[model samples]
Target chain A: MDANWIAIAASVLLQSSPLIIAVCGETLSERAGVVNLSLDGSLLLSALAGFVAAYFSSSLLLGFLAAAGVGALMALIVAFGSLALRQSQVAVGFVLTLLGDSLSAFLGQNFTRLPGPWVQRLPIPLLKDIPVLGPIFFNQDLVVYFSLVLVAVTTWWIFHTRPGLELRSAGERPEAAFARGVAVRRLRYWYAVLGGALVGIAGAAYSLDVKIGWAEGHTRGLGWIALAIVIFGGWSPLRGALGVLLFVATRSVISVVLQRSLGESSVVILNALPWLLMLGVLVVVGGRFSEQVLSRLPAALQRPFRGLLRAAPPAALGAELKEG
Target chain B: MSRPAWLPRLWPLLPSFVALLLTSLLLLAFGASPPLAFGAIWEGAFGNQDRLLTTVAFWIPLMLSSLGLLISFRAGLWNIGIEGQFILGAIGASWVALSLQLPAPLQISLQMLAAMAAGALWAGLAGVLKRWGVHEIFGGLALNNLAIILTNYLIAGPWQPPEGGSFRGTAPFHADALLPLVGATRFSVVALGLALLAFGLVVLALRNSAWGLRLKALGRNPRSALLLGVSSRRETLLAMAFCGALAGLGGAVRVLSWFDSLRQSISGGIGYLALMVVILAAFRLLWTPLVAFFFAAVLSGSVVLQLRTQLHSSLGNILTGVLVLLVLLFGNLDSLRAWWAEWRAGRRRS
Candidate 1:
């Protein structure tokens, strides 16, 4: 209820949004059985690309759009490896991370410390005026709001819509989906690209907000956290966003606490706090739930959905569109 | 399709080498001669006794850490968090070396024991999680991050030096506890050599021992291994423990040798590079040292690359990336076969 707490809470919400967006985007990727561990690299590339594009064009949309383009391109390479070449999904994911990190660093070399076009916050007047919960809920950058909408939309699509059903089917049982006339491979490609775009948007959110600065390892391990969040969410969008909220909020809390308690000597050591917690979550919950869920979860998460390999997807997912 | 008797194996390596070569082409764009740069890489690695000693010094920890990696991977487990394990090991050893004022030999032995124990504990936690249900990838990665943070906390807080200035690291290591560096090299020789000899034992154990066969069985097929009364989880814990111990040895060497001064980034990307080394060597322990030395050369020489060219340190990483990807892609010559078949068909049509 305090004024200062309100501001901090609002910032926390804003910070969490990018994580949610990245996690949701990665959800689509992993749900389709293609774990793009390259989220860190892709997010970094897009973050750099977004900042650079926004910086040059002085257009926020252009920057975010360019970020999406970069993400999709990176995703395409992963797709080329997994879908076309039938490589190990994890290996491809790993390769993409290495490639993506370097490429982002190389291309973003010019944009270091460049002033980026700040994404403006779109606060509803009445809502922004309210105290406490008002600013936290109502006032925010466009991407923060977009991320919330994306969560709802993604959940709805995956659970309610026909296309969503198809994608789910492809992810759960590609062969079954294939038998039912769904173009599983093509579906995977689009899902990965779209998912990548979302990740890119998340990266853009970082440049637009969240310390709109650039450097090597700029995005740090947000991408990997996104992957972990997806699993923590149990392949669900709403849960994924919550996980991100938890992740980013804990991160913000760590920063504040470290600032208050930890002396100068503690800074370097304290920097590892939030990440340690994230890993702790995985070791504790992520560890136990993995066996239980993996036993019942999609059998084809890592293995390619080879039509010849006879891997069956969930019923009704990716039913053939029957195009001429 | 074969060009020579040994072509299959030799051919498999060609793609990765080419990939590394092409990545160097990127250095040329930065105004460095690719061949000349490679020459520097060679010199930095093994051009002479001095260079070789330095490279070996660098090679010791890397070899120790990567052999640990190979131990896990050979059993079909991936412990990318060896970096974290390595950090924990260093801390463990540092705790013994710095905190306890025991006799020289006893201090060293206790430090080694504690270091290995700490690594085992950290990695074993991951193994427990993996067995409990989390996959190795997620569990190991999370453990890696946690270990790093914890290490940072320890080194920055209790172990922090009094006159901490620019660089944030632990206090100076006691000279007695420092791993004996052989020759005029900056790298740790005795520590690494001892570690390498242990690696030989591990290699022998993995290839010829019953435990090794069981692990291979687990890697090749979990159900079958389980059917044979081999507990995959137990094997995973044992292998992970071994891996952690090896990484811990590296960490101790790091503390005693090059980084007698503490560092947050001591393990650096060595854990990740060890992953790549495991990939390059295809899970062979002996090959780990060779491949890791090659990478260490690139890492050490990359400073020179920065001196000579406009390229970033990322070039070395990118080269390693391309190599890892290429090796995995071309493993068993699948791509080359597809390419060769296409070429032959085109030739017949012509």
Candidate 2:
């Protein structure tokens, strides 16, 4: 039983690695005040693009690069729409999502169900020798390690570094940031595109590492979950990683339980678990109930506890930044 | 020479033309002849009386969903969960159709009522969540997923037809429960009339009613609206409920007049498509129904394109997305004009 639990934990981490990447990417974008609502469609399109690129070239690296390109391009459109045209980011992202999905379906029809290359697992020697910790963290593909590193790196960048401070200010108070000589619009465009490229990498991760093939709507609905997890994580990279792990763990457990006890119909209910869990988590974290709970805590504990439980998003998220 | 007054009026059409050009380029890249695809689309959407009626059938639901979205947009509420409300509406209508036995007219009316109620209830949950500090976009998206799951559970589980389960849907309703058709076409004149009536009502309400003015004021500036005696909470709830009702009516027409059964994906992305329509219409009431009809034609025409070119049906959706994006970009011509003038002046100086 202990062995089985460890295996489950490892599997959960592996499954959630891509999501961690996506949530982190989205956290960065939203921090810069742009919401990439195109994550779902972007994921699907990039998955297809990655798979196709890898299939034709037989190069896993090329596949990931292609995915990142697709993702960045999508993000660029969102940035252009929001920054240049002064349109709603949400609306543009939503339309892009639909467009991306359709384009993927149309373009990927020929490649569906075909076998393609997958990332081989690479276990670090010394780390793999460690007991449960080794298997859970060390015995994974390159993307998983990258995701793990991303959490620490992103957290440090966002909270510790000066550039990160500028990024935050761009989202939190664009006009103020501009007044202080920060190039708010340029920063927003760069962050939105960079964040989108990370999302594309997540898509490639799914196709080349996690799910391992191109299929219609491949990685469908997960983009939305990443969006939700970003909110659940309070836009903190570390917390967002944790949120992804929690979501994947819950889904894995529910699927296991349902497979043992229920038939095919239960699959629909199982599919909804992540969404319902995310909703519950958001309510607990963001709702008034959380505020009351925080107020009741001891003064010393309250600040830290509130920080963990109620991390607010950047102030100017989703708002159009105007020229001073 | 002074610009013609009508030139400003023609600005909106520029986006459509640019989108068409871009789509033509895309088609050429795909190795399909653009003119052939365009011809097929036209022929499929409006070649005959039968085809035209089918386009009309598509128009009804699209128009209704757009109207629903317009209401929410006017109230500054982003009710993204209209897709879920639409599904619940179908479930509600299906439940009434299956469980209740009444005369044809009464049954149809009751089914529609039940559908509207179900949609309202679903949308109201999001409104309540918003009031409780949950952002409506997140809440609505979550509810959309939940509603789809619920529909799937019903169709595949407890409410599975006697023939066992099929993802296609539950069994067709009794003949009496089915909506009456119009003159040999699958189209229902009553449903079309209802849609037109709803459109008329919405236009009138938006244009003339105090409630409409209040909703607009609230959307434009909540603080000012509050200062002017508008209750934000009450208006929010009303706008959401009304929007849900319109979306529910769209779902009802889809189920009763078109498919005649419940399926997991009964909403068929109509809710999202309606959003695109609303965007393309630029929130103007007069332009919405026309845009909806144009989109409906694209949808129906895509089938013909599929048959002729063997291209994927999603081409229509791609077109819709491209068109909307272009429209959004071109919507602000003043900014573009100003930028162009500044660039020209700077180039001459340099």
Candidate 3:
């Protein structure tokens, strides 16, 4: 029973790697005040591009690079359309979402269902010998390790670094950031692209690691889930990673527990769990009413509850930057 | 002295040409002849009376959804959950069709009313969530998925046909429950009339109503509108419910006319397509139906484009998506001019 539990935990962690990467990427972009609403479409296109590149080049690195390029190009369009042309970010992103989906379907016709190169598992020799923790953390492929490291590195860079401060300021108060000579628009452009590149990596991760294969919608609704996690995590990388884990764990538990008890057909309705959870989390943690309820909690419980429940978007998020 | 009178009016349309050019380049990359492919699409959409009627059948639902979107967009709401509203509307209609045995006209009327109410309630849930601090986008997205799941549940569970459970859909409605069609084609004069009436109502409501002014005020500046005694919450809910009602009615029309049963993917991204229609029309009342018709034609034609060229039907989606994006980018002549002048000034500086 214990071994089975360890196996489940390891599988959940493995399942969560791509989502963690995506949530981190979206969190980074949102931190810089741009919502990459094209994620769902971008993921599909990048997954296709990534698989096709890896298939042709026989290199996982090239595949990731290709996917990242696709992601960055899409983000560049969003940034340019919004920043340069003064278009609505939401409008441009939404259009790109549809465009990316169709573009992938149209272009990926030949590549559908084709097998391609995937990342190989590389268990750390000594670390893999350890007890329960080792199997869950160290006995995984490079993609999984990269996701784990990325969460830590992103959290540190966003919270502890000077450039991160500028990025935050660009999202939070661009006028003030501009007053302080932060180069707000430039920071937003770069961060949006960088975040998009990470999202691209997340896309490649799905095709090359987790759900390996090229298909019409290789990563379809997962991108939207990742976007939701960014909000659930309150735009923090560590919290976002935790949110992904929690989400994946719940989904795993549901599939295992509900599949046997309720039979096969009932499993379909259980697909709604994550969406319902998304709505519940938004309602429970996002409102001022939640904050008020938290304030009434016992003193020791209040602190942890506050940290878990604080949900505020960047102040200037999705607002068009105005230059004086 | 500088530009012709038509230039100002016509220049904004440059993006659509650019979009076509870009799509043609994409087709060329695929080693397909652009002219042949476009010709196939034209022939497929207008080849015969049957094809034209088929396109019109598809147009009713698209037109209805687009009209609904006009109200929501006017109030500055995204209504991304319109898909879910459409689904709920379908479920509502299906429930009436499956459970009741009424006269032809009564059955259809009940179905339409139930669909609108279901759609409005689903949209109102999103609006309520927004009031509770959730953005409509996220809430709508969650609701959309839930709506899909609900449809799946109904199809595979209680509403499952007596034979066995399958994801295909519930059983077909009785004859009285179905809309009166034009011979064998799915096109119905009743549905078309309703869609036209909806368009007229939307145009009138947007142009001349006092509520329209309030929506404009709210959309322009929420704080100022509130200060001016315009209730943002009430208006937001009303606009969403109104959009949902129309979208629901469209859903009913879809199941009754275009389809005889409540099937999986009932909305089939029609809600999203309607969004594109509204955006491409630049949210102008006069252009909504025309753009929608154009879209309906392209999509209908895509079936033939795929068969003739051996390309994916999503080619239609690609064309429209690119067009919408380009329009958003360079559609406004003033913005495009400003961007051009800025580029020139920067070049001179360099």
Candidate 4:
């Protein structure tokens, strides 16, 4: 492959790291029957908090921790509001998102364009020397590497462990899970907060690693993209990570094509491409077209095809659970 | 155990009071005097006739958008893409204003119609997706971003002024295409009057019409409404399209009367603010305009807050968010009370 192609592949991985983390986080939350719709605002506020903490302390670790803390707090509010107050999760999340956006813009004004600490690249020794896969996967910053590990770890945790079964039961049939000795509400709160913290780490990754600066609306619109990916991923961690990669790849390709074929004016069109593509993906995935195609397959192939094409959301998702 | 009528009347206002108190504390934390900031906000919003007129100008679009959202909310749909619809409306109106050479009134009316069509078409896309099982919220959000990008492309690309590309927006519309301002203020009385007319029409339709009842029924329980012979597909499309038209009309009024050009942030987050207004009004058509006006005042006041205190104007957004959240939490006080009572009774039995 050409060096340019190799570089593009690496860049795609780098760009997708934060999104991958965020997608996993949202997938985990949604799988546990909670929807943290405050992803966008949470990202902005955490991005700001991460940048400021890193700048003041000169420690990237502290920045990531601060970002995660902020993320968890926002998630905790959504969980508390929905679980305890019996408020609509969507409403509470939406309000927090707007509030977080404005608060971040207001608070981060001073930190805009300021130099801050960033994550350093930590390439694995043996893996970095491999010909094709090495540069794309193993050679990156700590966050990028961690994001890959997160995909595998999250996939394993969600599908392989005993707690994973409990989580699924909590989301799919909360009353049944409660009868089976599960604390559905408490489990929801834990996963939502945990998922939110991961999302916060994604934000910090944007500031302290990927984009690497503090700016107003710095992480703008990314949270929404993450939310869409969670859906596209069918609320599964591995699939969600793949969805992020696909989105990032599309974005990269669009930018490259725009640079090659069009002037700066057409950049607007390029900017619209990701959203349009996501819309198309959503329509295809959620629409009847897929179902029609699935039915046309042989009966032997039909079940697997349906499984791959249709990933239904958890049955008890978004519903309030009452104690017996 | 009957509640006093006066207490019920005052109950809805509690959330606003709590939000304001909390926001005041936020101001204090920022080292600004809450009283001084609020005083400035009040003065800036309605202290003078000129400011009051400006507030009205802002209120028109907000009211229109809120009314649009009210329609969709009543139909069990969340039209989060109202911002996109609003932008498309501006684009549609701007196209008409720029391309058409008609008499002023005829041109303005045509522009509004074009805008409404554009908005309906945009929102209809989301409706179609929703009909196909795509969630309206996600579809709307994607469409919203696409619409913004489309608007930005138009303003900075083909619609770029003859002087070349600039983000300042297209050249001001022809003088004839512009709405006549009320006195020296930017406020257009005709636009305000039309908005009120729209509001009145919505109120009438929602209250007395069979269509309104069907929509309310659809929202209350889709399965039951469907069993009752309300066509979900048709009603969903109609509700979304009508809401889009209302939001489109808002965009038309905004472009023609105030800004007089297309810009990227022309919607000015009014779509989201309108959502908050609808929530605050509890979907009551009667209170939408009042809530919208209150929000507009806060927005206008925030501009003054920025000028005087060097505080960011987004403080108003923060205030709005706080207010809506508080209302969402406290709005269910009656239900919470009942739940608590039931819990205590159960505990007593145990």
Candidate 5:
């Protein structure tokens, strides 16, 4: 029984690694006041690029680099289009998402469902000997460890670092940040690119590590889920990581527990669970009801509750930035 | 001053020309001939009578959904859940067609009405969720999945054929329940008439109606619109429902004419394609149908493009996507002029 539980826990962590990376990447972008709404498209295109590159060059590093490049290029388009051309970010992102999807579909015709390279598991030296926690967290591949470190680093960078403070200010009050000589446009441009590069890596992680192999829409709707979870996590990196874990855990439980007892028919209905969870999380954390409820609590409890439930977005997010 | 009379007129078509150039470059990168692909699409879409009719068949649902989107977009709503609403419409029409014992005309009319109501109700659910502080994008997305699951359940569970359940779909509906198609084609004059009627109504409503003015105000600034005494909640629900109803009608047309029974992927991403159509049209009423027809033609032609060139059918989608992006980037004359001026200034500085 214990072994089964540990296995399930480890699988959940492994499954959620890509999402964790993607969510952190998105959190970084949203923190810098840019919303990369083209995540779904970016992810699909990058997954294809990653798989294709890895297949041809036979190197995982090249696959990840190519995917990140594609991701950064897409982010640059969104940033430039919205900031320079004065187009709506959502419009640009949405168009890019569709463009990316079709582009992948057209370009990836020959690469569909073909077996390709993947990340090999590399357990830590002494940590694998430990009991439950070791097998669950430490006995995973490089991508999994990277995701863990990414969450901690992202949380620290966004909350503790001086540059992080500037990023927050860029997202929360670009005009004020600019007044303080923060170079908001340049900061936004670079951070958006950085975030997009991380997103690209996450896409590669899926094809070269998590899900494995390339197909059209290999990561469809995941970008939207990541986008929704960014809001659900209140744009916090740590919280977003937890959200992905919780989502992946519940999905595994449903597929494993329910699918066994209910048979094949239940699988179709079960597919709706993740989306339903997304809606449920957004409604619970996103609404004014949570704040109202928090306010009604005792003084001692209110602070913790407020911190836990806070879900407001960055003030300057998606706003057009004009350079004079 | 010495330029030809048509030269100024040609400026408006600049985005299309640019998009064509970009698509040509993409084709070249793929080691495919642009002329051959374009020729394939053109021949596939309009080379023969049958192909023209097929393109028109695809156009009916696309036009309906695009028209519906114009309403919601005017009200500043994304209505991404239109996909779910479209599926609900198919479900509603399927319900009527399967269970009803009415006359042919009555059955068809009832099916359409049911489809509209189902679509409106589904869209209204998203609107209500929006009212509850859930953005329609998330709500609609979730609802779309739920709608798909619901369709799958219906087809595999309760509505399964006499032989047994399968993922293919439910059994075909009775002849009386189906739409009267034009000779040897899925194209129905009735569906065409409905779409054209919707187009006329949308144009008139957006142009002359007080409601259209209210939607414009709301879309521009919701808070200010409320301050100006516009009831945003009422307008939002009404606009979403109105859009859903049309999309549902489009769904009804799909199941009733395009196919014989309720099936998987009934809308086939038409809801999303319609969104692209509206955006490409620049949200203008006059251009909506024309752009939709263009999209429909490309998509219809893709089948032939694939068959002849051994290329994937998504080339049409890529072409449209590129066009829309270019339009978003450089379609506006002001943006183009600004970019041109900036380039010249940068060169002089260097």
Candidate 6:
């Protein structure tokens, strides 16, 4: 076990970065009383678009931008359906999932088995020289650095800002916020799109780091795992870091252990451990009274801002605006 | 203020057909005439004696599995794991017929029963999980994966055929265990017969039974059904099991009728296609045949285009995605329907 201890830990951290990015983005959305169920589809489409953009243009920044653009476009579908037409966000999101899958498969069909750009790693001078921590932390790629900062910045935004206060008020009691003149719908749209952009980067992070080559059906269920981590962390940024760490760690362990314990074909069977574990965690969370506690949670959760029915995070997240 | 529901029904079908034709036109875009490509697609699928036989063979399992999809949708459930269930069913049927070494006639009956039971139990696990507070989508997703893995484990481990790793599947069932097909149609005569019978039974059950009423009520409005004490949990669990059994039957027929053995990709995304079929059929259990046959033709057609033209066959996926999007968006749009109907009435007045 000690033979690969340092390497395993390094890979685990790397693997967890995408989850961290996705969850942090979702954390923002959930905090504002909107749940973007299309995180899975958004991550997928963006990941493909990112890979495609970089493959043709050979620009990593453009790849990242493309990912974010795709994410916002996917989120737009959720925003319009849940916000404008007032359809159930969950339903629309599910439809988006199916569409995302077919569209990706169709688009990626030609691109499958094609070569993609390799993301360059940047190491800081002084920090890269720091003992064991140097190679493990400071010598990581750019997204790795942004993911950590995003968490801190999100934490600060929620606790310290004036607009954040109104957003919180909107999430907690939209009617109250509405009476106080907080534009709940507009705020939610922004949060959803922003969150979507973050999730997009999270997807592109895959092609940039772990599996640098492009492929179809890549980033399978990572978005779903991020959603589970959001709930597992109780929708807090700091704790969500742990949940993502735990998920990625489990997946890393499963691959290593199953390869040793089971043959190749059987190993295919166990490839789904990470996703199954996420679903299990979600089921456990749902059975707990946390959903009720969900309403009583942070003042800004399931309810959109600037309307009635102020509540906590996602008792029924991604619900359509009823306009009552 | 509600317009007649049937008024806008034909619109969705028309778009789907247009999309299907345009996909074929893509073949012409590559230099094959639309009619020649269409003719080749039809002939390759059902034109001659042998191709028609194999086409029927292909249709048996797909149609059966799709019917299973309709059953679940009727209860407002999306049993997306039908592909997994279909695979497991084949595995179960193979395991029984081969491992048990039963008499000829008794072997297949037992195998079919085992397949159905495996599917029901697998789906039942998800049902029980949902009953305990898990969402159906998550539960179905998990179970789909779990079933795939578990079946892979079975096939790759103890059930690994005596032939070894060159082929990763079970040993062929006994000769008598195989079902006979119609002249050139690849479908097992008995399996297709049973499916037809099951079709009638499903229609009757949905239309006449007290249980059917309960399911319909729950699907339409679970909250109101709960108020009426319809026991949503129980009905949902039962509906999932029923759907699973239907899918399992399809799996059983695949081995006995078409492929004659199980493989890793036994169901081959048919479960997903079944989801599309259910939506396209508007969750009509009886409409399963019509939709599955139509899509099956499109699928086989794409394969023809591939052999004729070097372009990607996945163009079909893009088209299907477009059709689904239009149907979903337009189906729920009250404003769109009203505008179309108003325009139609205006034309009539003139």
Which candidate achieves the best DockQ against the true structure? 3
Query: How many steric overlaps does candidate 3 have?
Result: 0
What CAPRI-style quality would you assign to candidate 3? Answer: medium
Worst 10 residues of 1 chain A by lDDT: A305-314
Worst 10 residues of 2 chain A by lDDT: A262-271
What is the C-alpha lDDT profile of model 3 across A88-190, one tens digit per residue?
9999999999899989889989987887889999999999989998999999999899999999999999999999898898899999999998978778888
lDDT of 4 by residue, B144-193 (tens): 88888888788887888888858669988898888899887779988888
Q: For each model in turn, which proportion of the native inter-chain contacts is also found? A: 0.50, 0.70, 0.88, 0.72, 0.76, 0.34
Evaluate model 5 with DockQ and give the value: 0.72
Q: Rate the local accuracy (lDDT) of all candidates.
A: 0.76, 0.88, 0.89, 0.88, 0.90, 0.73
Kindly report the root-mean-square deviation of model 3 from the true structure over all alpha carbons: 1.8
Worst lDDT run of 10 residues, candidate 4 chain A, spans A260-269
Q: What is the TM-score of chain B alone in each candidate?
A: 0.90, 0.95, 0.96, 0.96, 0.93, 0.86
lDDT of 3 at B2: 75
Give model 1's TM-score versus the native structure: 0.87
lDDT tens readout by residue for model 1, B232-316: 8789899999989988888887777877766878787777777777777766666677788778887776656666665676777
In order of appearance, the predictions have TM-scores of: 0.87, 0.96, 0.97, 0.96, 0.96, 0.85
lDDT of 3 by residue, B1-350 (tens): 37677776787579889999999999999999999988988888888888898899998988988898999999999999999998999999999999999999999999999999999999999999989888898899889888988898888888999888576999899999999988778899999999989988988898999999999898889999999999999999999999999999989999898888989888888888999999998898999999999999999898999898899889999999998999888888778787788778766976
Worst 10 residues of 6 chain A by lDDT: A303-312
Tens digit of per-residue lDDT, candidate 2, span B107-164: 9999999999999998898898887677778888888889888887888776789988
| All candidates: DockQ | 0.37, 0.66, 0.76, 0.68, 0.72, 0.34
i-RMSD values for every candidate model: 3.3, 1.7, 1.5, 1.5, 1.6, 3.1
